[model samples]
Target: MKIAVCGKGGVGKTFFAGSLAGEFVLAGHPVIAIDADSSPNLALTLGLSAEQAKAIVPVAENEELVRLKTGTNYSGVFRLSFTVDDIISRYAVPTPSGASLLVMGTVKAMGSGCACPAHSVVRALMRHLVVERDEVVILDMEAGIEHLGRGTAEHVEILLVVTDANLKSLETAANICRLAQESGIRTIGLVSNRIADDRQEAAVRLFAEQHNLNVIAQLPFDPLVADAGMTGEPLDRSASSAIKAIGELAKKLRGLA
Candidate 1:
């Protein structure tokens, strides 16, 4: 299954995406976690050390790789199509959770139809992963779906929009859901994260109902999970409330598949 996790920034989209990738690995499936954020941090979330994360480069920022795939001699022209299969084999970094991580830095001005060589390469790679790859692919997308073209968005099987109880977060979630629907995605699930109490959960639920979003899961705020982020430690899969909630959501997604 190809799943995209997107929402407003700082809404815990990376946490959910990384946890779901680990859960898929535990279920005996090969998982590929893609970090499409401009400021990529999924590497740390998937258990990579700070130094290791710093050492690895993002695909869009890799001048050599992008030029190799899309560079052309003609002025201001580039190859529109190329094979990205070799990219996966050579660039995907293996994580401790048995899942591979791919950091795909954002293409600047892509939403404005920038046809630069780097943008072409990144766009092609995104399409290749969602439409061609057999393994389960989970993308921690940018703050909005504007980064995804219709071709890429339609191929994704599920889109999980995450939010907290904050009014701004819920507003962003509602906009993302509308964009996903317009992009031809049929199954859009709402995930509420970091709910501190019953009142917060109720607010999220009410917002979802008002916007016609399907609330699939609610993950309580776990202090241990937050501490791990600060200390650069991996989350405790066995004991984390957020991890358990994600595990159940993974099962529900597999069942739907």
Candidate 2:
């Protein structure tokens, strides 16, 4: 299963993605976690040490390596087609949750129709991950669907739209789901996060119903969730409300798969 976790900024999408990766790994599936955010914190969310996260250089930022994979160093001639099958094997860092992670930094714009060597490499790697790979892949994406190439949108099994109970967050979720639907993505699941009360949960459900969304799960606003990384804890039912919610959502996704 290929899932993309997206929502408004500060919506806790990274937490959701990382938690899902853990659940998948627990279920004995090798997960490839792609942190496609410009500012990636998924590594830490996956409980990687400070040193491990710091040591990882994003594929988009590795200029010399990108040049080797694509014909970008020596000649002006650019190749749109490049093989990145070995990229994950060579570059992915192992997370404590047993998932392999690949950080894809921001792709800068050169010019209209110009071949962006870095962006090309990132896209190629993503294409291979989404279309060719057999294992479950989860992408912690930005609110905008720029990272989800239109050609690979349908290939993704699920586009998880995470949102808080606030109206602004709901508005962003609506817009993202609309754009994804337009892009030929079929399954867009709405995940309500940080619900403070019954009223907030109701609001999120009503908003989803209004937008014709499939509300997959609702995660309560547990203070423990914010403190998950501050202290280490084993993964089990003894976890926090948010973590339990995340685990349930992961199970729901697997059942659907």
Candidate 3:
């Protein structure tokens, strides 16, 4: 399953994506978790230590790799096509969660359709991961789907727009849903995270109903999750009810696969 998780910043999409990847690993499936966010912190969430996560060089910022793949002899030219399969084997970091991590760092001009070498490399890799790879791939996207072109986004089997009960978060999720639909993604759903009670969940469901998007999962607000984040500790899957909920959600996603 090629799943893309997106939401406004701080909506816990990275946490959800990381936990979901770990669940798939626990299920005995190979998983590749892509940190496609502009601020790439999915590494830490995937059980990498702070030092290891900080040491990661995003694909977009790897000058030597970009020169090898897209650089040209001409002063202002680059290759549009290149084999990116080796990139995974060469750079994917193995995490304690049993999932491989690939950080696709941000390109300053990414959303503007820049054809620079770095952008070209990132785009090609995105296509390779979403459309060509066999493993279960999960992308923790940036603020929206604009970073992913239609061709790449179309191949994503599922687009999960995560949101909290905040009005701004729901609004951002609605916009993301629209963009994903336009990108030709067939299965799009809303993941309501950090719900404190029936009232919050109801608000999210009402928003989803209004926007005609399915509410796929409703995760309770777990203080344990917050505590882990504050202390930079790996979430305890054995103790976190939120992680268990994500495990069940992972099964539901696997059903689609």
Candidate 4:
């Protein structure tokens, strides 16, 4: 399955994506967790050391922007010389349980008309993974839906949007839903994070109902999650309320316990 997790900044999207991938790995599925966020934190959430994650070099290509001639028949060709396995072997980090992790490093913007080679390469690799890879591929995307708009949306089977229990966060979720609809990507549901009390939970549900969105899961505010983040611990094994909620959400998504 190809799952893409996205939301506004500070919405715990990475946490949800990482935890879901970890759960799948624990359930005996070979999983590939792609940290598509330029400012990535999924590696930390998955309990990977910084040194281990840094081993995988991102797909960096320098391509000249040239229009292809009509009837060139170049659709199946790739510009890169490296195979996916080679790239992964060189750059991917394996967790203790055998799941693989890949990070898409950040790229700086050049002047207008400047090509985005990193974005192109990441998009190509992602497409290959979704179409050819047998393992479950989970992409943890950045806050905005821009990546989805850039043709990656079709590769996603489920688009999970995360949000906090606040009016601004709910508004962002609604906006994301609209963007996803415009991009022709189907949303699986919303996961409300950092709920402080019953009132906040009620607010999240009401917001989802008003927007015609499904509230698939609710995660309470937990200090352990913060500590785990600080310590680079795996959230899947944490006993925190938020982590437990994420595990349940993973089961719901997988149609199993």
**C-alpha RMSD values across all candidates:** 1.3, 2.3, 1.3, 5.5
Candidates sorted by TM-score, best first: 3, 1, 2, 4
Score candidate 2 by lDDT.
0.84
Angstrom error at residue 112, model 3: 1.9
* TM-score preference between candidates 1 and 2, better one: 1
Name the top lDDT candidate: 3
Alpha carbon deviation, residue 90, candidate 3 (Å): 0.6
Report the error of model 4 at residue 97, Å: 5.3
lDDT for each residue of candidate 3 in 168-242, tens digit (9 for 90 to 100) = 999999999998888899899999999999999889989888889899998889999999999987677798889
The lowest-lDDT stretch of 10 consecutive residues in candidate 4 is: 62-71
Backbone clash pairs for candidate 1 read none
lDDT (tens digit, per residue) of candidate 4 on 1-257: 78878788887888778878887887788898888787776776777777865654554422222111111246644344333444556557777646688876653322234244455455556667766677888888876556543455665667778999878988988887776776666546788998888999999999898999988788888888887677766544656787678778777777721
Give me the runs in candidate 1 sitting further than 4 Å from their true place.
108-111
Q: How much RMSD separates candidate 4 from the native structure?
A: 5.5
Listed in order, each prediction's TM-score against the native is 0.96, 0.92, 0.97, 0.80
Give the range of the ten consecutive residues with the poorest summed lDDT in model 1: 107-116
**What is the C-alpha local distance difference test score of candidate 4?**
0.70
Task: Score candidate 3 by lDDT.
Answer: 0.90
